[model samples]
Structures are given as C-alpha cells and as structure tokens.
Target: MEIPQIPINEKERLEALQRLEILDTPAEKAYDDITLIAAEISKMPIVLINLIDKNRQWAKAAFGINFCESDRKHSICAHVINNPNEITEYKNITEVKEFDKNPLLEKLNPKINYYCGIPIVNKENLALGTLCVIDHKPNQLSDAQKTSLQALAQQVMLLFELRKKNSSLTKAKEELHKQNELLKNFAGTVSHDMKMPLSNMILTIDLLKAQYDKQLDFQGKKHLDYIKQASFTLSDYISSILTHYETDKIADKNNVEEIDVNHLLEEVIDLFHIQEECEINFIEENPVIKVNKIALEQIFINLIGNSLKYNDKNKIIISLNFSKDQHYYYFSVTDNGVGIPEDKKDSIFDLFSIATSVDRNGRKGNGIGLSTVKKLVEGLGGKITVESREGQETSFKFSIQKYSQKKTA
Candidate 1:
C-alpha cells in the first residue's frame, strides 16, 4: 500500500520547528524514559523515540536496535505528526511497499510488523519529535495504553519547555552580573584618578599662602590671593565629582520614603541664605513624593546652584512651583540668569560638557552637575528638561512619581 503524501507547507513547518531549537540534539532521558515505559507497559519487543529531521528519522532513544537513522520516505512517525494527539497504527509496515523495501526494515529480526507513534510538541506548537512503540508481531493498542502514551507525550513537551526557559533565564542573569561589575570597576578607577591631582593642588596652595604671609609686596599678595581662589575652585570641582558618585549610589531607588517637599525646599534655601538678596517666590502648596532624600537634595542643590551660577543680575529672581496631574508631580525652577545658547542647549546635561563659562558669581564648576541630576532623575523614573531664551531667562521643568496621600504623614 502506498502512503498518501501529506501536503504541508515546508517553510511554515520548519519555522515552527526552528522556534523549539531541538533539531539534531543528543538523547535526553525525558524522551528516553517515556519510550522505555511505553514499551514495558505495552509488552512490545522494540521501542523508539524518533525525531523526524529534514531527510532522516533520528532516534532520541532506541531499544533492541543497532541503527540510529532511516530515510524519511519510510518513517511511520512522519505520518504520526499529521494526526496529532492520536497514535498512528500500521499493523504491518512490510505490507506497505515504501517501508518494507527499505534496507533497515528487511534486516529486522521479527520483520517489523506493527507501529504506533505519538508526536511531541514544544511551547511553540511544533512537533519536534515523536514517542513511539514498535512490535515484531502484529498487535493492537488497548484504550488504556493509548491514553497513557498521550499523557507521556505531554510530559515530554513540558520538559522541553522547562529546559528552554531555564536556559534563557541563566543567560540574562549572567549578562546583568557582568554589567554590575563593570559599573563598580569604573567607579573605583574614576575616584583614584581624580583624587591624586586634587590632593597635590591643595598642598601646594597651602605652602604658597604660608610663604607669602608677611614679606609679600602688594603685587605678590594679589597673586597669592589669586592662587588661593583657584585652589579653592579646584577643591569644589573635586567635591562635585565625589557628589556625583554618591548621587549614583543612593539613586538606586531602594530608600524612598515620604519626604515633605516644602520642608526640603526650605532647608535648601536656608542653607544658601538666598532670602537675604535673592527673592525665592513659591507657587507650591504642600506636596510629597516617595524618593531618596539625599538624591533629591543633590538634585535641588545642583539646579538652584546652576541658576545662581550664571545670573547676570545682582539680585536674582528665582521661582519654585509645583502641581500634580494623574500619576506625576511636576516641578519647575525659573531664574533670571544668563541664558543658554540655542545650539548648545542639548549638550548642557552631558558630563564634562560646559556650554558657556562664567556663572552668576564668576565661580566655575567641574560641569558634572547637570549630568548627575539627569542620572538621579532617571534612576527614580523621572524626567527633566531645560528651556532658555537668549541671555534673558532660563527655566528647568521636571517631574517625579508622587507618593499617595495615605503614604504621606
């Protein structure tokens, strides 16, 4: 009898098979043990777990067999997949002209009389292989035997899915571990490189001030004062770098608690004593957020200090405002300062990227402040933006996730 050809779209079937990634693999006991159990339960002389590849039948497990493969044109399991969830039974493969004439079957000890096969599927709904039982004498599978074989096929599919999921999860964990190590190494290297030069500058400035204490002429005294100021500026720069590093650590977002916004802003304003000359206008009502306090302080200091840094006016007008809508709390800080240039606006938040020099008080910084602010905001799942028009004014608008009223004291 000639087996009718099952018209299947090869591309679709192969694509489905590829998703499982189980082609041409070594034998797994999950598939092997099911074959053995089926053979013992059914009292069959031979059992095979066959995987139908493109051109061959590959046995994942075989009992009482020497050969590992046979031509696909003569595989009983190939037909088994066409009727999934049901076993295909051929009482005699020898009577089937296609399989009987095959070399492997002709050499069979009991002449390969009966065949039963069930297809194994992975998560992608692909029949990657088959669980089969064979017999030398013609036999029919009982209803109980058929049900048991089907359940065993499901177990084989579950094992394949579990292995695939485990493999993917292991790879992701490894990649994350590698990334964390890189961040730690970079933090260590940057600390060492920055501290050495800062230490030398402080020591040299101290010596210069002592040497010029009493015997210095007017011009010499002026030069010494200049050296002292420059040394102090360098010290501030080193401090800024260290602050940036600390900001990164706390910004991990694990220590978020109910923080009072009004109180925090007042503390920052008082620390700077901006009330003396600089008027701080508040458009804020009481508000609170779940955020790391140190990181929030770092953000406030960097931004407020930035406003004071490049101010052209003797008395600066700074404004603070807050509002809530839906899930986000918005904050804006506007200042009458020397505005940023339109072309270099976007680069202002980049580390070591200074747009134009000369802050409000003519003091310079190491230029990592805005970059640190960006990193901190992102760590807390927030966003920030800056707007400026010529040398007239500049404003920073930012938003953060707010703590619910119940969570606030």
Candidate 2:
C-alpha cells in the first residue's frame, strides 16, 4: 500500500500548525460541534478534526471514535492536507484500480468504503488539518452534503485563527501589567528621594524668616515667601506624581467598606479649609454604600476642591445630591465657579489637560487631580462627567455601582 506523501512545504506547514497552539489539546465543544454537523450532513458514523503533525494525524475533535491519533502512514486525512486547496473523496474507491490495494480499505473491521475531508487552511494559506467523515458502509455524497461539509471545514479554520488572536491579546495584556508595576516602583522611589530635600528647604525658609525677622527688608521677606511657596508647590507636584502611579492599586477589593456617604463627603470637605464665604448644600439621601471608601473619598475631594478653587461668586455656592437605585448610586456636584470653556470640557478629565489654566487663587494647576479622580472612580465601577456654562456654574455628574462588579468569588 502507498503511504501519504508529505507536502513540498512540509517544514513551513508544520510551523504554521504549531503556531495555532491547538494540536494535542483536549476536546473543545466548538470543534466537536463542527464534526457532528459534518457527520450528520454526510450520513456518516465517524467524523474528526484531524490535524496533520510531523509524524501523526492527531484528532482535535472526534465525534464517533475514542482513539486520538495514528501514524502518518495509516492516515487518509494526511493525504487530504497535501493538496491544501480541495476536498478529497473516496466513494467505494476500493473497487477502483488506484485504491484497490489501499490499506484504508482494511482500516476498519467492516472495511472502510467511503471517506471525505476538506482542508483547514491558515492566514499564510497553509493547510493545517481536515474536517473529515468516514463510513464503513458504501455511501455517495450529494452536492448539498459536499457544500455543507466544506462550510464546516471553513468554520474550523476560523476557530483556529480566533484562538491564535485571543492568545496574542492575553500575552500583550500580561506584558503591559508587568511594565506598569516596574514604572510604579520607579516613581515611588524617585518621589520619596525628591520630597526629602524639598521638605528641608521649606523648613529652612520658615526658620530664616523667624530668626531674622527684625533685620530683613520688605524685598528680603518677599523673596523668602516666594522661595517657601515654590518649595511647597514642588513638593505637592512630587506627591501628586506618586499618587497618580499608585492610584491603580488604591481601589483594592479589600479596601471596600460600608460608609455613610454624607459623612464621607464631610470628611473630604475637611480636607479643604474653605475660608471663603461658601454655602455647601447636599440633599443627603444618607445612602450608606459598600464600596472602596478611600476611592470614593478621593473622587469627592477633587470635585469639591475644584469647585472651591475655581469659583468667582462672592458666596461660593456649591450643591451636592445623592440617590441610588437597585444597582447603582447617582450623584451630582454643582458649583458657582469660573466654569470650564466649551472647547475644553470634553478633554477636561484627561491627564495634564486643563480648562481655565489657573484657579481663582491664581495658582496654575498641575492637571493631575481630575485625571487621578477619574481613574479612582472607574476602579470602583463608576463613571464621571461634567457640564458647565462659562461665568455661571459647572456641574459634575457621576454614578457608582452598589457592589463591585469584578468580584469573582
């Protein structure tokens, strides 16, 4: 009996098949379903997704057989992958001269009578395998049956391609996660080293002013104050940078706590000592929620601080509202502030992107706060948005989920 001849591009074809990462893997219902459909359409009892490996025909999915593989010399599907572009059919081929002495004729106890297989090809146009059906009894495939089998074979190729793509995406995500961890470590070390010297400078400036208070001129005093302010600003910038990198870890699942949101808002307000004539109001639905408490507080602090720092009204009027439904809590913070320009509103949450350039206090923003706030909010399964009328007021609306949607256990 003649053995199946290897394809001319056997080396490249084997590489392409291996790249799919599918050979010898356990059965998948997706591939099994195709074999079942092929069997039913052809009125055959045995069906298989046979992958042609170097020395064997391995079954990825077998419908009516328990065996998984056989030597390439005994595999009829091995011959089918050779053409790489067409279906091979043997209908009572044993009665024909060429296959009269074929070993496939005695492949089964009852003697194999009919066999058909369509090639499984990849993006490089290399045939990798076959979706084939076998029957021990004589059978003739109809035009409709052949078309359906060919379609099922194409579906098998699509599954292979999809699996390769998903595997690639998973690798990319893992690599990105590793890179982010390294960056967070570097930022933390640098910020700590930088802040120590800045802290010393700030203390030295304050000490110099107090020790020589009687001798220093107005210009000398002003210069000392400027140096102190610059030191503080730089320190703040370093802290903000560290916070941005560490924000991703802040919304940890273990950080979740039951909180009275009204009290939480009060805590965030205390973070800002607003000496201005300001009226802060909230409907205070008293919605106690279970979520990452620190993350929510971080979100509230940025929004409230922005309102206070950007306002121009004599009485800084800020209002807050909170309500919740079956699945989520909704909130809105509105303020009489030097509102954001229309053009900058959409990109206001982007890191290092500012709306009005400077706050009412005339301090230029580092543009890190709002973006960090957004990351914190989303980490807790929430979304935030803003709307404003320049010279009037700005309103920030956001929603938080009642529970963490990502909890797997």
Candidate 3:
C-alpha cells in the first residue's frame, strides 16, 4: 500500500487539528446524527466522520463500524485531505491499482468494493479529514447524493469550529473569574492595612487638639482642622473602594422578600443626617416590592444621597415616586439639583466618574457611589437610567422585575 504524502502545510494543519481538541473524544450525538443522515441519504451501510491526526485517522463518529481509529498509511481519508476540495470515489476498490494493496480493502469482511469520501475542509482550506461512505458491492452515488454528502462534510467542519469557539469562551470565563477573585482579595487587604494607619492618625490629631486648645493660635488650629478633614476624605475614598469590590462578589440569588418602599426609604434617610434645608418628600403612595432587600437599600442610598450631595438649590427639593407595569416596578428619584450635563449622563454610572455640581456645602464628589448603585441594581436583574435637562431637574429612574414567589421557589 502506498502511504499518502503529507500536504506542504502539514505542520500548520496538524496544529489546527490539535487546537480543535477533538481527537479521541467520546462519540457525540451532534456528529453521530450527521453521519446517520449521510448514511441514509447515500444508501451506504458504513459511514464515518473521520479526523486526520499526525499519524492516524480517528473516527469522531462512526456508523456500522466497531473500530474507532486506523493508521494513516491505510486510511483513504489521508488521501482525501491531500485534494480536500474534491470528492474521491472508487466504484470498485479492487479495480484500482494504487489501492490494490490497501490494508482496509483487504480486511473487509463483506469484501467491500465501493468507497466515497468528501473532505471536511475548514475555512482555512485545510482538510481535517472526511465524511466517508463505503459499500460491500460496486455502487455509484447520484449527483444529488454527492451534493448532499459534500454539504454534510461542511456541517462536520462547522461542528469542529463551534467546539473550538465554545472551548475558548469557557477558558476566558474561568480566567476572568480568577482575576476577579484576586482583585477582591487585594482590595480587602489594602483597605484593612490603610484603615489602621488612618485610625491612628485621627486619634493623634484629636489628642493634640484637645491638649493644645487654649494654647494654639488661629493658624495652628486651622492647619490641624485641615489635616483632620483630609484624613476623613481619604477614609471615605478607601471605604468606597472596599464597597465597590464587595459589590462585585454579590452573586445572583433567589433571596426575594416583600419590602415596604416607604419604610426602606425612611431607614435610608435616617442613615444620612439630612440637611435641615433639604426638603425631601415621598410623593405618591409607595408600593410594597418583592425584591432582594439589600440591593433595594443600596439603590435608594446612592440615589437619595446624590440628590442631596449635588444640589445647588437653597432648599433641595427631592421627590421620590413609584409606578409599575406588568413585569417591572419603576422607581424615580427626581431632584431639583444642578442637573447632569447631557454629555456626562451616559458615563455618570461608570466607576470613578466625578460628574458633580457644587452642593450647599461646596463639596466635590469622589464618584464611586453611583457606580456601586448601578452594580447592585444589575445584580438584582434590574436596569437604571437617567433623565435630565442641564441646570434644571435631573431624574434617575430604574426598574426591577417584580419577584414571582412561585417562579423563584
């Protein structure tokens, strides 16, 4: 038997085949179904979805056959890959001189005489192997059958491509998960280390202020105050970073509970010492929502805090309202604050976006709160959006799916 010569691009072809990771895999129904259809269409008793490896042709799918593999020197599939785009057919293998000593033909129990193979060529024009059919009697395929066989070969190539893509995506997801874990650990470590030093600094400053209260000049007291404020700001920034990283770890869960919107808002408001000048109103009747309570609390805290933080009005008028549709509960936090600029609206929800206007106290924003809120909302299967007119009123609207107890349970 004459051994089939390897293609000029044999090295690259073998690399591509290995990357597919299909060699020696257990039979899959996707490939078996194609071979079964091809067998039915061609009226052939034996059919195979072959993959040509470096030294052998492996059967990914086989019908009417027991063996899973064969040597390349004895494989007709190896010959088909050399002229991959064309179908190779032998009406009677015994009549062909080159295949006269072919081991496969000599070993057939029924003394197989007919063979046909359509090469499974990928988009790169490298044939991996073939979709082949064999018969025990001299036979010929009709033009339609040959066309259908070639189409099935293409389907086999498509399956290979899909398998490679899915494997790549799975690897990427695993890598991303590892990276996120590392980041979470890093954030926790840094936050803890930095907080200790900050606490010591704050304690030292307060002790110095108390001991030197009457002895200190105005400038000395003012500089000390500045240090205390700066330390507090740094503390806030670190806290925000810790919160953001922590939110990243909140996986989706079916932890839904009925929560009174009015009571939740009242608790969030109490957490922040609202300015006497700020006129915060819960406008309409609030709906009792079935939701992840922690996520809902986070949404209100950030939105209401921002409304109070960014306002330019003498009396910051903030209105909270809620409405609902069949699928979602829509909540709006509208504020007569210095509204979000049209250009900055899209990016305000992004991490570290410092799109702020001066509040009553003239404090600038650190820009982590809104992003944390966005993450929490999305984690609970909700979406948030903003509507604003520059220098007028800005409204932040968000929707969360009303939880169905039966569906979740």
Cα-based TM-score, every candidate: 0.56, 0.87, 0.92
All candidates in order of lDDT, best leading: 3, 2, 1
By TM-score, how accurate is candidate 3?
A: 0.92
Give the per-residue lDDT digits (tens) of candidate 2, residues 1-409: 5688889989999998888899878778898888888878988998988899999889899988776888788788888888878888988656645455655456656677778888988867788989888888767888899889888888999999898899899999999999988888898999999998999999999899999999999999999999999898889888888878878788675677898888888888888987989899966567777888877887788799899998888899999998888888888999999999989988999988888877887888888888988887787677999989999999999887777557687
lDDT of 3 by residue, 1-409 (tens): 6789999889989988998999988889999999899999999999999888988989999998776888888888898899987999999888977787787767878788889999998878998899999998999999999999998899889899899899899999999999989988998899989998998999999999999999989999999999998899899889988878877455244777888989999999999887558877885686787878877887788899888878777788889988988888888999998888878988999988877655557766788898988888777677989999877798998887777657553
Candidate closer to the true structure by lDDT (higher is better), 1 or 3: 3
Candidate 3 has its poorest 10 consecutive residues by lDDT at 247-256
Report lDDT (CA) for all predictions.
0.75, 0.85, 0.86
Superposed model 2: Cα runs more than 4 Å off: 8-12, 93-111, 212-220, 252-260, 284-292, 403-409
RMSD of each: 10.1, 3.3, 2.4
Local lDDT at 284 for model 1 = 53
* Model 2, residue 236: C-alpha shift (Å): 2.1
- Candidate 3 residue spans exceeding 4 A from truth: 248-252, 357-360, 406-409
- The candidate that wins on TM-score is 3
Whole-model lDDT, model 3: 0.86
CA error at residue 49 for candidate 1, angstroms: 15
